[model samples]
Target: MIEAYQKLWPNRASVKNIRTQQELEQQILIELNDELTHPRVRKSKEEKLALAFSRIEQSDLTKQQKKDLVSLYKKIAAQ
Candidate 1:
């Protein structure tokens, strides 16, 4: 979604300039892959958990499933 893309790349000109959903997705994927693969750009555990939670919120899973998954993630993070 446009909102997700904007949240991920708030300062990216491409996010604002995208003319199609496909283009926006492509740009987002490229940036996400770069961030993920770049060793120096490692995200902290809490940041990763937050991103995961955001994704779970956006997914098509049932509310109960999302709740369970979030609880599981929190338990894992606490360890």
Candidate 2:
């Protein structure tokens, strides 16, 4: 998780220099709050999935195609 944060916010000094478990937890909480409250941060996986499903619903794809796509998504998620 630290590695992911480092990759996402390489400029964040706290993320780059975590030295203890407590500090890591604190940094994670701070970053998580930032992610939740900041509009410009990337959306969570569930949000992105919901957006994709919504787009699929709005698209002009055939019903069977949509069903197939959803089934494929479900299968992938199951793994």
Candidate 3:
């Protein structure tokens, strides 16, 4: 990776820093790509995840589904 970075940089010699402008830009692009792969977050999605247990709290036969839902909601909330 370092070798490739040096090859892409025209002023490799003067660039004493480990990460050049191009390398930094590439890193940002990689991170953006990763974030973009996830579906865009929406207000409704947040609202729904926020109310994870509200409806189910009073419902019966929700034990197993609640475990799955809480786990799923936590995962979404984290992102």
Instruction: Give the top-scoring candidate (lDDT).
Output: 1
- Number of colliding residue pairs in model 2: 0
Question: lDDT tens digits, residues 1-79, model 1?
Answer: 4554455446767678777766754664444345545678776667777886888788766677677656755755675
Q: Rank the candidates by lDDT, best first.
A: 1, 2, 3
Instruction: Assess every candidate by TM-score.
Output: 0.52, 0.44, 0.33
Model 3 vs. true fold: TM: 0.33
Candidate 1 yields a Cα-based lDDT of 0.63
**Top TM-score model:** 1
Q: What are the runs in model 3 whose C-alpha is more than 4 Å off?
A: 1-48
Q: Is candidate 2 or candidate 3 better by lDDT?
A: 2
Which scores better on lDDT, 1 or 3?
Answer: 1
Q: How close is candidate 2 to the true structure, as a TM-score?
A: 0.44
lDDT of 3 by residue, 1-79 (tens): 3333333333645333546545544442333233434456523444544443454454443466556545544544555
**Model 1: which ten-residue window has the lowest total lDDT?**
28-37
Residues 1-79 of candidate 2 have per-residue lDDT tens digits of: 3343344446766678976656655664443334546577766545544654665577666676666655544443344
Q: What are the Cα lDDT values of the candidates?
A: 0.63, 0.54, 0.44
Go through the candidates in order and give the C-alpha RMSD of each one to the true structure. Answer: 8.8, 12.3, 17.8
For candidate 3, the per-residue lDDT at 31 reads: 30
Clashing pairs in 3: none
